[model samples]
Target chain A: MTDARRPLQIVDPDDPRIAAYRGIRERDLVRHQKRFIAEGTSVLRVLAGQRRFGIESALILENRFAGVADILGMLPAKTRVYVASSDVIDAIAGFPMHRGVLAVGLRRDDADAAPDTARRWRTVVALSEIANHDNMGAIFRNAAALGADAVLMDAQSCDPLYRKALRVSVGAVLTVPWHRFGHADAMLDWLETNGFALAGLSPRGDAALEHWEPPAKAALVLGTEGPGLPDRVMDRTQTLRIAMANGFDSLNVATSAALVLHHVRNARTGPASG
Target chain B: MTDARRPLQIVDPDDPRIAAYRGIRERDLVRHQKRFIAEGTSVLRVLAGQRRFGIESALILENRFAGVADILGMLPAKTRVYVASSDVIDAIAGFPMHRGVLAVGLRRDDADAAPDTARRWRTVVALSEIANHDNMGAIFRNAAALGADAVLMDAQSCDPLYRKALRVSVGAVLTVPWHRFGHADAMLDWLETNGFALAGLSPRGDAALEHWEPPAKAALVLGTEGPGLPDRVMDRTQTLRIAMANGFDSLNVATSAALVLHHVRNARTGPASG
Candidate 1:
């Protein structure tokens, strides 16, 4: 094992090697470099551990976080690991701290890999401007766990690799294969062309969730919290409304997605299978 | 209608009017205060739009936001509305911008309400720490939408009314009745005493979610993401594991709650019945 002291490379905030870690603002990364930050020991493990997520860089805290060091040791020796004082790390990230680790990676284009249709893929998720990172991450976590094959977000959605999202997902964001699509129209078009039946989740939808029969392949579309899927989107797909108690409006997008995903997954795979 | 012009309060950060918004450091708010912050028009609208929640205190951005006057005008005359310059508001909140509005509200304690008879309130949620405000908030949102009547949190849980919880919950935290029990033990005891059968969510659980028939009155207890509910808690309750794709470990806590809540609600009420 490469020891912490030997593996550690102390770098100031200005180190060009750590550019990905600097000025970790959402817009700056999205608009300027089209990248975002991922933090925590688990996310790093997921990225370096998984290998196919297209992660481009690594930045680890210099402290005695040997677990983080061990994880970094697994990465290619060429991967840049910047060890920083906790103060410098805080200043660079604009937060008090990360989970004793941080990394900056590319925001893969919204539509990166082509969706695999075969191999028993049944349920998937589509998101609108669900811009809250944590919600996005959680939804991904749910979709992955409920046997959803893919998670597609709209262009306006938050970067799932945002540090908060990574934490909220418990690093599931990295593990799950997620893509970004265009607006409702484009997403609808793609799903239709790809032979995936679509279901829009809406409170006012006439169909109840219990009656929702999952087609052989299905895509569940969820909108932002306040206003659900756009009217145009709902027009294109069958609507499934999760019945709620009176006076209660709706569930979080992620939570709603989970319920829908579970139903769809169950309908496709049969019961008691989870 | 009163014109929007008002004297901006140039009070120090220590001003008691903004006390509710104080100590909002992202981490300290979690560690020390056991809370996090949520700001802006959208979150507040969610809080206000929901009739079940109550207003705490408002920091109105003086004259900056057009079309907001009508909304502010509707507030009760006794409601504390602190008018501040956008700069002061932003500075006090430790953000570059304040979105022209902010409010601080107390965490709702719903546990005080008597748990209705098992037949009347067929579904319940028991949560472990789920300390992330967004997840906590999202869980409440799911519980309400999916027909879970009450939320019980163990000692390690996050403060649901913490601003982030309020925001993520879309103010559902205020509306959803939750109780803080000593821990899972106390919560489980209460559930059993109330004639509620307990279902613990775990990966190692023998009973899959689909296999278990929804009991007339049941409480589903969910633990954190990485570590599902403690073994002791699982030991006390019927362990139910959500089916998932083989590689994926588990759904996010809130999402799991939503899925289970949906199943329980659907089974008890019969879908379309709600």
Candidate 2:
């Protein structure tokens, strides 16, 4: 492991070595890339300890490097840390950087390589077409905090590794084991084969969540806010509703995930709403 | 009732009648004003239905008017409706408006005039100092959905009426009765006098939420993320913790509020975590 030391200094914004860091705010460009950007001190710290995702390199503000050198030191010896001035950093991102720390992380894509990703989880969260980055991030955060062992997202769902989602998840995406399925049926088949009971959340559900008892292994499948799960998907899973005070008070998609994930964790471990 | 008629045409962006709508993106000016902006069809719909927060007027895109005129028609007959071209709407906002519907709302400040505000709440969410608008909005949404009768915010907390907060809340702020206390002590005294048992959520809570039975009237006091509630506040309330899988996985402030509020509502109404 590399010990804390002076990081490489990049005085120029157009430095070819830091190509991946340039104009990162360009949404389309960042999306097609195989890697993901991690931002802020909290997320960077989580990335330092996790092995599920590999850290490619780090770009830090000159002043911020000192504050986070200890965290960077924990990465593999091959990990690169590039320190730059605020101007260079802002120019590279195509926007003024709010927090100083940024890093590119390589997705391991280990589900097919290693079945442990699918086999290990007792409590899972399967997301069906979540488009909002904030909601996507919140789902991962809730899953990690409530002890949902794995997170599975459909292909239509936005990338969890997106900078906003990564920061919002507070880097839980790094810690919690996750797999992105190419399609909804693939994810459903995997969950079914893995002995995970599928519980789809909807406005009109077959049973109230508390009233429905979970089996030994369970998966909480969350749908997008407005148009919930498709009939085909709901047909395969037990529809559970979070009964509200009135028809008007619709909970946010992320908020619903937190409530459901908490209930499943309770069923597997201890009390439901602790 | 206007009965969904064609809105008044706005050819120029600099129309003085729409001054409040001009350069609305300027954050500071939006604050310190008695009125607030409500954005998107969802928020506008809620504003139209509620009498507690009075609707001043509305600004809609020429193309988007027909889609939301029914919603706008629900407003009072005196409410002026302005329909502008995309250019004018974009120029007035200083950015391209994603959702065409925007409305100005008047804060009634009727807590003093009407004791019904203080007297009606059986369950309340008291925010200590929430800086994030998204979290603030989500808190209100969860409180409203989970049967929290009122929301109380300390002076330092961000305004729920802020555009992003209102939009993220799905306009729950308009539906849920709320008050902003000038100071922490005032909020504490109000809850105390109103017969609400204060429960401050902390990592090091005195009792697990599930085990601690809530009284008839209870208030869940939430602190800002990172630096949680101050000792002075926690000393007065029963400190509660959301038991997590590990110390590493931290819940978002709003996520914690949802869980705690769900638990409180369950205690008062039915089963916890439903």
The global C-alpha lDDT for each of the candidates, from Candidate 1 onward, is: 0.70, 0.82
How well is each residue in B1-274 modelled by candidate 1, as lDDT tens digits? 3332332375577676677665455533553242234466756666555544456667777765454555556554555667777677767767655466776543334324444533466677888878887678778878777767778788898877676676667656656666777777888888898788888888788898887788877888888877777878878888988877767776667777777777776676666743
- The DockQ of predicted model 2 stands at 0.55
Give model 1's DockQ, 2 decimals. 0.60
Error at B259, model 1, angstroms: 1.0
Who wins the TM-score comparison? 2
Give me the candidate number with maximum lDDT.
2
Give all TM-scores, in the order shown.
0.84, 0.95
For model 1, residues A64-154, the per-residue Cα lDDT tens digits are 4566766776766556566777877777776677465776666555425455533355667888788887688778777667767778777
Query: Candidate 2 — which residues are off by over 4 angstroms?
Result: A1-4, A27-32, A109-117, A272-274, B1-4, B28-30, B111-116, B272-274
Question: How far off is residue A234 in model 2, in Å?
Answer: 1.2
> Which candidate ranks first by DockQ, i.e. highest?
1
- lDDT string for model 2 (A209-265, tens) is 877678778888988889988898999999988878775636888889888877776
Q: What DockQ do you compute for every candidate structure?
A: 0.60, 0.55
